[model samples]
Target: MIKVETGLADFDIGSETQDVARHGGGAIASFVGLVRDDGNLQSLELEHYPAMTQKALYGIAEIAKADWALHAVTIIHRVGKLAVGENIVLVVTGSDHRKAAIEACSFIMDRLKTVAPFWKKEVRLDGTDQWVEERQSDIDASKQWDE
Candidate 1:
């Protein structure tokens, strides 16, 4: 299963994890990304092209599923105004072995960070808003899977 959501709704990680774990897999790996308080960020507003974002997410999941023996995959990303320490993204992967599940989860996150068409705007405590730039580290992380 592949899911891509962009809204103000907060994801329930435990329920999602349980759903994946019940897919007859021995191991389930998950990752949850949260908005950081760095730079005195007051809130984050995420924008994306709805159709394109969902397509990109599904594409990434497909790649992981093909490369690994994954039984299930779930990805939920929240949009709109998110305060610091709020959940931003959730990724879960289930497989028969821990190695495959772990690698697939990591691969999905790395690819999503770079490949997904989501734009982030950071609102600082001083009431200043700036578009966030993608870090070179994220690009490098995604590139590792190419080899």
Candidate 2:
């Protein structure tokens, strides 16, 4: 099972992800991406194309399932004005082995950065904001898993 949301609330994906992995008695790994207080921005507002965002996330989940012995996965990304120190994204991967769970989590995050149709607009400290563009590094990260 997978759950995705765009609300501004803290999530508990680890426990849920662990449950899925534990169904068969194995390992689970998760990641929580938080907003940074870097000089580049004072705040971040995320806007996503609803339908496309869900589709892309599911696609990433499929890739993880095919590549690893995963039992369950969950990915949640918040969209809206998010202040620093808030959670931006969460990913959970379950598998029989620690390595599998860990690797799958990394793989999911790397691909999501590029594959997901999530646009981030950063509000600068100087009261200016700009939309972020897809970077080549993001594309390169996803390529590592290509068959």
Instruction: Find the candidate with the highest lDDT and give its number.
Output: 1
Which residue pairs in model 2 clash with each other?
Answer: none
Mind giving the per-residue lDDT tens digits that candidate 1 earns over 7-81? 779999999999888888799999999999896899999998897998999999999988998999999999899
Candidate 2 structure quality by residue, lDDT tens digits, 33-147: 9989886678999888898888899888888877886878888898889988888999988778999889999999998997788889989988998988888887887788785
After superposition, candidate 2 runs with Cα above 4 Å error? 17-22
Displacement of residue 2 (Cα, Å) in model 2 is: 3.2
Query: Estimated TM-score per prediction?
Result: 0.96, 0.88
Candidate 2's displacement at residue 19, Å, is 4.1
lDDT of 2: 0.82
TM-score of 1: 0.96
